[model samples]
Target: MTEVRKGRTAKRAASRAVKRRALAIAADGALILYFLFALFPVVWMVILSLKPANELFSTYFSFTPTLDSYRTVLGAGEDEGVPFVRFFVNSLVVSLGAVGLSLVIGLPAAYAAARWRFRGSENLMFTLLSFRFAPELTVIIPLFVLYQQLGLFDTYVGMIWVLQLVTLPLIVWIMRSYFADLSPELEQAALLDGYTRKQAFFRVALPLVKPGIAAVSLLAFIFAWNNFVFPLILTSSEAQTVTVGALSFLGGDRPKYNLTAAAALVSVIPPLLLALTIQRYLVRGLSFGAVKS
Candidate 1:
């Protein structure tokens, strides 16, 4: 009887090990396929950007690598009137401003929603989410007219405000969930120790959710930076962002594929750099609700 029990336990353990190995193999295969799908276009774009203009359309497909395309896009040598620098600066300003504004407004609103049970709070949150999901084009005409009347058309302020609609609701929802997952006892203890509500929030609560804040800020910045339609309709040369400026590659006769590819690669650098910098915080924030304490 003792030998039979030992034999049964050994068989079960071997079966479990086999199942685990199978699962790992499946997961690895999925990850590799996903990585290829995600990275192929970016790899192709970089390859195209490195090719010379004449080679871009040549019959034999010249494989010669050159820096001329990058120089043109960066205004390094021959390309003088491209306005790359202005567009790049404008993108930074608008993206940062939009993210800052969203945090200022959304963080407080999220805190309220998470900590307090106000009337119609759920309805308000849903309304905000609805607005976030709505198509940007639907509101563009109305906003264009309004901005014209208010003299905000073709201005950085107007562009930033319009982008807030894209980012604010996402910030509120993400931060609110993070705040909810935190222990209320910490804030209560701070209050008992004579910390004002605002003080407790700024000192205790905010620090605890720094990961969430960073993630939301990164998301908001990306949204505003990549925004094309709002800037396309509302801005001209003065406030044009990298996205709108990239369209300059299109002319009456033919599209400058080499220049556009170079411009696209340049445009991708800032966001790529930012994502790499904040990748750790992003991972933590995304995993906020994955496990329960």
Candidate 2:
């Protein structure tokens, strides 16, 4: 009787183990499929970028690859390749400047909104957030007029200022949540220990939210970098970002799809590198305050 029971128990354990392995395999298969789905566009973009102009419209996957497309887009292969390098630099400058200014202004604003209650503070924060909800087209014409009058049109300063509409609210809202998740007692303790309010913020409160800062700054930078409508309408050449400049290839007689693809892949490098550099902090920042003890 005892031997029979032991054999039955062993069979049941083996069955459960087989089921668990099958489930794990199914989950991994699903993940791999999703990853491929997400990566297909990028793969296709790369393939498009590699194909020579003649091969661009070919339906078949097999192709002779060449670097001419990349060289042309970089201004080395063509005499007048639309100044893509300049546009790339403009994107970097404008995006960085926007993020920098947002950090300077939004950090304090977020901390203030998180830590204190003042008259109209809610209204003020809501008003700032409302900028995100409204479509940019609604205000672009007025802004165009204003930029023309103020002589901010096609200037780096103008692009950065306009991008505050994209960057500032994100920083303020996300960092405000970070600040709120923090215990005020930490800052209060710093104050009691002879730290000024400003010092407490810089030393105690700020360091605690470093992960959030890194994450939000990356997001703000990407938003600023990808913005197209503002740059397209506001700037002609001097400060046109890659988003607008990439379209320049489409201007000449035949649309240079190969050059456009190469330009796009090149433009993706900065934000991709930035994300990889700070990926650790990004995960922590996103997960922070998601759960409570």
Task: Report, for all candidates in order, the number of backbone clashes.
Answer: 0, 0
Model 1 Cα lDDT, one tens digit per residue, 1-293:
99999999999999999999999999999999999999988887777778876777672334888878788877652354567767888898888888898999999998888989878888888898888899889999999899999989878898888998988988898899899998999999999999999999999999999988988888778888888889998887888899988768765476777777788888888888988999999899888743211
For model 2, the superposed segments whose C-alpha errors exceed 4 Å read 1-30, 290-293
Clashing residue pairs in candidate 2, if any? Answer: none
Candidate 2 total steric clashes: 0
Instruction: List the candidate 1 regions with Cα displacement exceeding 4 Å.
Output: 1-38, 59-62, 76-81, 290-293
TM, every model: 0.85, 0.89
**Model 1 global lDDT (CA atoms, 0 to 1):** 0.84
For residue 211, give model 2's deviation from the true position in Å.
Answer: 1.4
